[model samples]
Target: MATLLGAGPGIVAAGARRTMTRCDGLASVSSSSHGIERVYLSAEHARVNRTVAGWMREIGMTTRVDAAGNLVGRLERATPSGAPDLDAPALVVGSHLDTVPDAGRYDGVVGVLMGLEAVRMLREPGPDGTGWRSPLPFALEVIAFADEEGTRFGRALLGSSAVAGAWDPGWWSLADDGGTTLHEAFVAFGLDPARVGEAARRPEELVGYLEAHIEQGPELDERGESLAVVSSIASARRFQIVVEGEARHAGGTPYDRRRDALLGASEAALAVERVCRAEHHVIGTVGRLETFPGAVNVVPGEARLSLDLRGELDDARDRVWRSIEREVDTIMGRRGLRWRSAEVHRAPAVFCAPLLQDVVREGIVSTLDRGVDDPATIFSRAGHDAMAIGAVTDVGMLFLRNPDGISHHPDEEVSAGDVARGTRALAEAVLQLAADRG
Candidate 1:
């Protein structure tokens, strides 16, 4: 596989250092003076788009911003003039540009920069080294999706959903903490909501979509592997559960007579951990909880908690969810309390296309030492832009190891060596797809 690639072997020659420098540079676009905190449709978002657009131009890729605010760079050699042709078949490589609040530097940003570097590596230097050229059968396009983190709008995949043709108009009414509706933000960001459909890509015009991201878990790091072919992205279901009970005098109510909603919610949360832990790849987290009736002397009459459940398969996840519901029902009924749940979000599991998986595997193999056989294979526990993009085309991912399997935080880290390997592997995968397509 190494011989199959034009570059053959070794690091891309200080490519990793340049990649790290770029990551550091982008971290400056943070909203907070203390750490990285870029969000969708923000001044920070617009600034980074301008900065990345200049980098895309450096590699001879013509760039544009989609109606959903995603930055797209196309490197199509089909036209001698190098102008973009929307109808041209292209292999799209992308990752989100947005970040969670107080976010890690590498989570989504590294993937985007790596994609940019991979495109740089795939090109042949133009005469006198002024620009570059691609020898692939299909055009190459890199996308920096706008809202994968959903930090500002509270709904993820706003950018990729539009490209995947799965945009829901209902989302326009959603407002942020600042009270600005999504529709208003779009307009403020210089995007027309009515024209967002223009951002959708035709299936025939796409060859496939590939993304490179930091592994958000400990599997790769624990196994001493730096890269893996992502087998699948976990399915997720989110809900808001509310428990209702009578507010009473905290000290006056007898133990047997008191119907405590806070107690019910607390027990339900424990039940979720117990039930979900029994299943493989099943995770249930009660991240947000609130107990009502402010006085310390008064018993809480209402409690609300958020449930985020994820699993490797849909059936298994549903089974776990049902189990949790039964547990909650029992806890509430036994306590003489009423309970209800409202679903907030749901996303089904997405498996990588077999061909894409194979190429990614080979790409990783090309960069590893011969002492170790078989590159690692992993399933993504965290949701990504790939989940939404999978709806429209054959989608796949390359997971580069992140130390301690931690993400969405300032401490998440990726090494320079891993970046070099990851950059080369991604480029190789793109070249391999070209070879197979031809």
Candidate 2:
């Protein structure tokens, strides 16, 4: 058996370099008009999956495309005596392959590629001439989930949710920018929508889910840490808010006599920020706003806006929303404007399992054996596939430092060294889990 010392920094660094090369190659296959935009079931999606499948096959994994269009690569575990054990529950590792419009090269891509690298490190012989020192007790499955960005269908986590048996039938009616229904796109992509349920796995089928992603925030960079353990994923809710008033000529109508919907909406947006600021770890944003009859001389009789609220706790997020709603009511009442809001999306916070957290902590400590005994635990303000997978099994997350805390854009980046550290940490975590299970 190979010693842990054989998979040291040098070997890990080589693996990370390979991972970066693969990510760059995949980035070139995007379908973005401005930047990187590989959405669900698009031609780019198929191309990337083909490339990833090739990589998986090279590592001796059996690859398949799930009914929900997720790309899966399976490496069955073997007994200590080298006998294959096909019935073992899988230790799944992965992240979404889809991207937002004009996205950066890392984000979810790093997790998927790093996962493959970790498996490779485990399977290859170490420098000490020992082989398969830490054979996993469970099968290892790497998944490149299909639609976490929701760029094409406007519903995130479609791939992971399908795997968790949370597929919603109404999603078929969702339309894309090109007026194509999701159901039509599924058929066009050669995916049988009728068999989506086949993608769902029972709780007993999985040992757990683990993901390694770039820190989409500045916390890790500020702390000067290369990796950290995720404590929980934030809860989030979205709403479409509308304000209504009478229309008139902007120049002719007196300011005192006019009931402007745009003015009311502007005040409501500000109130959202103010209310969110009062609560700890809660955030609210008005990301989109538009005025009807957008002529220079016409008064904006109607205004539409979007609200996104998120918090570390479900009750806290709900409280902030209620406060914002009250503020909106006051703003509209004084302006003689009517207001209405429609909920668009909602997701509750998901906490990592304590056992999984310990394993991740050990992995981080083992990789970076500095005086750093305690790994930083950060709460994720962004949603992830782990949230959906949490429904079926325990979930854990490891975050690598993103230099500028920038993500979802072209400037997003991670250091090759940090990627190397993250890869080693994840591989160690898997080994630790195997030891615990045995």
Candidate 3:
């Protein structure tokens, strides 16, 4: 299909070495933030601060770090009199930059890079040495939030919660693998640990929030779609279950005499799968398992397993959990094992606002109208920074098609054409929302 665009492509010079290295620099910066394993609350995360700050400077935006260490980069609106609006909080756009162990480079980084691209496209002057008028009405604030993965700190959405006023001060005391508190990491990074509240912004200060992300699921590619306007995020719950039984020597104990924790754990795992099958909108996975005394000649005395539960509805999540809890009790009674289950994490489903949903729809439709290919209807299985922002202001999400339908892995891939389409769609969405903010 012929590409449809309102304006001829503006001549965008590649950002100098610093700007060009945005991706490499971001990766390098993240690598240093926690010494190449920058988990949340790690001293290495501090390393990312300088890199982000430097890029904000090169991008011509004034940079500041919030109490939670969320970096906000502001670019004021050029008013009719050429006075930049200082009071306006501006339209915010960005995503987290942290990663899982050797995670795919594109997952969260693409969104931030796209936001930078929008800013770059907006900042370049037209052929006449005058800036082209922007289609969007609000000033843009590009952001690169920290610590969404929780791989190290074991708490997801740490930075965004602070920005949204949802993070508890007590959260600072939470420890990592090295027993280091989040607050101590903050102090080491030159931030005041006591003033995390300062990171909270009143709702009025935000005009809107936009995020572009990869389709972390196979829905888009499976359906042969190029992009998806996210309608809502699924609710997710995580649990850790431990089954205890008496350890017995393999040769000494007869098969009937064994009180094996591994056997009980296996039954519990299959029970989880069965419960999910019985309930629609419910998906359960047991991703990890550790058995005590994992010797070939020994029956395991204790087994610990992780459970991940997801549903499209709140009640569905509750129902699934209840089923699992019941199964755990039944399994323990039959196997003569002591068992316990603990909730590790819970994130409620989030619905994107109708107004912003319209913007996303308009953006996609506009792009297709301009001869962009077909888009898709999809929801995010993974959580996003926008979910927090959605609680505060108008928020929208754009999902680019993943060619491999895989993410959070090293082999994740997206076509360049798909990315370009996503970029145009995002730019169009921002412009439409900005221009029509009456």
TM-score of each: 0.95, 0.97, 0.90
Residue-level lDDT of model 3, residues 117-235, one tens digit each, is: 66755665546453344534567887778888878678888888888878776677887778778877788767898788888777889888888888888888887777899888889
Q: Evaluated with TM-score, which candidate comes out highest? A: 2
The candidate with the higher TM-score, 1 or 3, is: 1
Candidate 2 per-residue lDDT over residues 119-173, each given as its tens digit: 9888786575543445777999999999998989889999999999999999999
**Winner of 1 and 2 under lDDT:** 2
- Please, what is the whole-model Cα lDDT of each candidate in the order they appear? 0.88, 0.91, 0.75
Q: Which ranges in model 2 have alpha carbons more than 4 Å from their true place?
A: 1-5, 126-132
Pairwise lDDT winner, candidates 2 and 3: 2
- Ranking according to lDDT, highest score first: 2, 1, 3
TM-score between model 3 and native: 0.90
Pairs clashing in candidate 1?
217-405
Weakest lDDT window of 10 consecutive positions for candidate 1: 125-134
* Clashes (candidate 3): 6
